[model samples]
Target: MKLRKKVDKVLGTALAIIMGVMVINVLWQVFTRFAMDTPSSFTDELARYLMIWVGVLGAAYISGKRLHVAIDLLPSRLNKKGQTKLKVVINWIIIVFCLAALVIGGLRLVYITFTLKQSSPALQIPLAVVYAIIPISGILMIYYKLSDIINKQL
Candidate 1:
């Protein structure tokens, strides 16, 4: 429980910081394009990358909070024990999906990008770095799912 709280705090702080930077970057982009009559070359790419981080990390954060959208009908219909069993099964499903799709697939993608030395044109930042959030978020989600199972909550 304490670990989960700490992880939540760190992840939340990171996402907030990324969002702030993205907002500032986009604002600068808009100001430069229209107000200054010149666009900032790197701001667009930076914002895009930041958005990827936010979206992926945000998903993990939401999972930790058990705030992911879900139909409550089934669980609501069940008794307390049934609901808990269902939640455990669902958490296991989520863990498996994240492990297979996000962790494995994302790692493949990151490996390919790093191997190829792929980078964004404008930002010149490695795509591997940008794609790192996929596996990171996957790991976080797995942790949350496991925690949910151990705690008998979703």
Candidate 2:
């Protein structure tokens, strides 16, 4: 739990910084395009990439906090043990989905893009680096879920 909290804190700080930079980048783009009549070529692409990182990292942070949207119709009516069981089941489902879809698929995407040497047009950054957030977030989710289960049991 301590380790998880530490990891979450670090990730949250990084995500916050990325989000701040992205917002500033957008503002710069708007300012340069309208006021200066010279649109930034790199800002748009950089902002887009930063947004992707923010979205994925934000999702992981939310998952760690157990703040993801879910229908609580059944859990609300259940007893303590039943609610715990339901939560465990849901966590298991999340783990399986993350493993299958995010971890595996994301890794495959990173590999393919890296091998093909694909790069963003404006930024010229490797697509693989951008896509890496998928697997990274997935792993974070898995770690958080496992920690949640362990903490619950303890």
Error of 2 at 29 (Å): 0.5
Clashes of each: 0, 0
Q: What digit string (tens of lDDT, one per residue) describes model 1 on residues 88-113?
A: 88888999999999999999999999
lDDT of 2 by residue, 36-91 (tens): 99999999899989989999999999999878899989999999989999999999
TM-score of each: 0.97, 0.96
Runs of candidate 1 exceeding 4 Å displacement:
none
- For residue 125, what is the lDDT in candidate 1? 84
